[model samples]
Target chain A: MWQALYDEVKNEDFMIIAVAEESRGNETAKEWLDLAKPSYVTLIDREHHVADLYNMVNVPQAVWIDEHGRIVRPAETAGSHDAWRSMNREDMSMPEESTAIAAKAQKTYMDAVRDWAINGTMSKHAFNSAQVRTHLALPTENVALANTNFRLGFYLREHGQVEEGDKFLKIAVDLRPESWNLYRQAMNLREIGPNGFAANEDFFARVDALGAGRYYPPPNIEGFPTEAGFVPVS
Target chain B: MVTVLTEAGATEVVSAQATGDDLWFAKTDVTRATGWNLKPEGLCQGDLCVPVPKANSENFVREETVNIAGFWRLLGRPALHDQAGATWMLGASASDRANALQSLEAPDFKLPDLDGKLHSLSDYRGKRVFLTTWSSW
Candidate 1:
């Protein structure tokens, strides 16, 4: 857990940056950061500008920025190799005792970290310029459109002026209707905003159309796309 | 030199339209209910020429699952695809193709800490700050 890591690394020369338009007042984020005692920076982005800036499509994705403000690594929890991956197919399909592959991956990554901490740049796990570049590209056009609309819709519902964000959000629904985040956004927009767009039939129609016969909402929230247009079918 | 991502069903080549800078982008007539960007493959919006597979190759991607990493790969005109309901994503062919989504930054913001004081990025201008986001879910 990050709390554990914070206990370990919180006092070093480096600082901690918690990204999220996560908390509103100090009690939530500040309390934790203070408890950890690291020079911490708690940030919020209801508009997902950071997500857009770093191309972070997932939560807890992180990039290490060196002292000069240059990125040491693109944002992702490569550090999380220590943690068990939650969405393993084996776990999803059959969870009795098939963690063999997962264990191997964990050990490999752990060993890699030890190597990096000891020798730094000499570690094989350390990414080079080319490797890092290969890993930091954004989504394609279709995906980009989905991403753009989903984000636009999110901001519109949460912060921006009404109506315009919803229009784009509807297209997002049409694009990736399986996206729960998008669907949730649309619903929430209707629930809260100045638009007061009614819980229209068109919205449900979009959700129905998303998965069509196959779009099954994953039981685990983390496994689903946190984008627009995806409605939970049940 | 544009690239397109699409929900290219078995018959079509892409699902979504094409989007990028302007290098590989132009225009196309492939329009349906499926969402698509309107860019081309192999032209730089700047100096980047994102490629997209025309027909068959594009269908393969459309037929597959779309993940964050998968979407990032399909940036330029490199390759594309779509499925019936699943989101369509393309694969970028730029040798410099990096996964952009994984490296995004947290936006600048000012929120009151557990205390009543509002904290801003400007407050840390001269300092080195590391912010981490923790989630119970």
Candidate 2:
């Protein structure tokens, strides 16, 4: 999807930098990159450095930077929706209506990106500096501490200290529960489930625990859907 | 041996001393682990110097060693460690991160592509960038 967009605007002095926030290292990220064969720049991030620097709490987040290296948009959910929460657990099937809404939300987001790419600062989607700053999600003290613990945990685990690594990984999650990237990555690295079903169950349960909160908070942009079109299951 | 994690990567502070929660490093190791050098004026990284508070100078500096964690706390940055203090990770101060965002300048970073080729965000200057992140997990 990003590749297609990048192709459309590559000649307009627009570049797409896709970073894989995979701590398991290059091989894991390389497989997907090879499959896509994206023409744009693709990089592997084992340290979650980009996430830490940008204060991103989830995957598929994006930031917009103008030609002069100024941020026109801070990190936000990039064309993703929480419609997956409405999927049928037994069949792993999504309702057609939910799928359509999800597709529409994604298209809306992509269109906004295309607008910004072509029109640059003149685009309505391109936020001014003040608006960009307002949208920026600066890390809190706990979030910063969580990032530290997350890095330490990953480092220790990579160095063959599983038990000690898990300790800090758990602490990282506790320090910043809002960071799904930290929580999910920890679960992934630890191989929390013996099988896919157990992992799915755990993920579903966490989503359920959100209550009224969104799994993917809709991006605050013009024409963006404000709701996931379904009330989250309590 | 104490391992200090910074943006420049991990450094083993062989001469580090751990007292309870604090990790003290030789003045030389301070510059090795972190870019900041301990000069007579205070701790400095490049031209940015943060002076040790006169009232609590002992908290940051003690003879030939400086409390690495204390220096981070003094600068309002997060300094974290394990129970044994064998490993430590220093995080940027909230104010510093926030200030960068407030300035609206995209924080530049260098990362490696699949082929091991490195690319810095600044390398794409004069071009609009759509910087996005994903995970295979």
Candidate 3:
């Protein structure tokens, strides 16, 4: 999705910056990065600095900053149309419900992105200041604690203190069971090699456990006309 | 990776990144190391709320690294980061939640590219930027 966007806007003064929240240029992250070979800029956030900075609770969340450095759009789902449509149950071995969720998210996300690309702030897809502030996730007390515990646990695990790290990690997960990034990272620690996901708790299994109904917080593109296709919203 | 020294003991943290001025730890690491998380109410721990003064609220958080020095300062604890040694000595868990508000701009942070060169948000200040956060796992 980004590659195609990069191509379209290469002539324009637009930059697509991909921040790897937990990867930090590790082997598992590299495997996917190598495959994509993104022409755009890719930065590694080993400690999830970007996630905290943006209050991003999920991967592939996008924040659009205007040329003046103001946030034209707060972080929201930004999946590409191709990714959602290409998910094959037969080929990928994902459950029907998981794929359905992906498809739903990607369609809305891609349409909004494309509109923003063509129309810039004029795109109704972009939220106003009030809307942006209203939509951005406000960290609750539990969220804040969970974020802290997850960070500490992740650091301990990284420095060969698995037992200690797991204690905090468990607290983090238990604090915010819906935080997929935290849950996914914790599960992937025991996983070997640079494989993408494929952990003991697979993505779909976790999603199913969480119930596909609660998998993704609803896309925050409300009031932007969901059925408008690519039409600019004045 | 960076070294963290606490009263309990000295431990190395793999994810802490050092920028020139501040030793930044992710909110996760901050929670792990300091036991404070930025919540809607304030920088909070278990039933404890830390009041962050308004003056010190200027871009205290960059990227996602909470300013250990500033945070400790807010908590009125002495903290130091040895740049040359790449070490951070944390005093104690203070109520370091000064920059806990939601209206702040995303803090400027320098991160490494695939080749290990550092890049800052100021580098792309003039252009429309789409910052996407993701991971393989």
Cα lDDT listed for each candidate:
0.40, 0.84, 0.63
Question: Candidate 1 vs candidate 3: which has greater lDDT?
Answer: 3
Q: After superposition, how far is residue A178 of candidate 1 from its true place, in Å?
A: 9.0
**lDDT, residue A138, candidate 2:** 83
Off by over 4 Å in 2: A192-199
- List, residue by residue over B81-133, the lDDT tens digit for candidate 2: 77778888887876777777788889989999998899999999999999999
Instruction: Tell me the TM-score of candidate 3's A chain.
Output: 0.77
Q: TM-score winner among the candidates?
A: 2
* Per-residue C-alpha lDDT of model 3 across residues A116-221, encoded as one tens digit per residue: 7667778887777787777766655566556666665666666677777677778877877767667777766655424456344355555445432333445666
Candidate numbers sorted by lDDT from highest down: 2, 3, 1
lDDT of 2 by residue, A104-202 (tens): 889999999998999899999998877887788888878777888888888889888889998989999999888778887888787634431124566
The candidate, 1 or 2, that scores higher on lDDT is: 2
Off by over 4 Å in 1: A21-39, A77-124, A141-152, A158-167, A173-234, B1-137
Chain B structural similarity (TM-score) per candidate: 0.28, 0.91, 0.53
| Chain A agreement with the truth for model 1, given as TM-score | 0.52
Model 2 chain B lowest lDDT segment of ten: B91-100
**Ranked candidates (DockQ, high to low):** 2, 3, 1
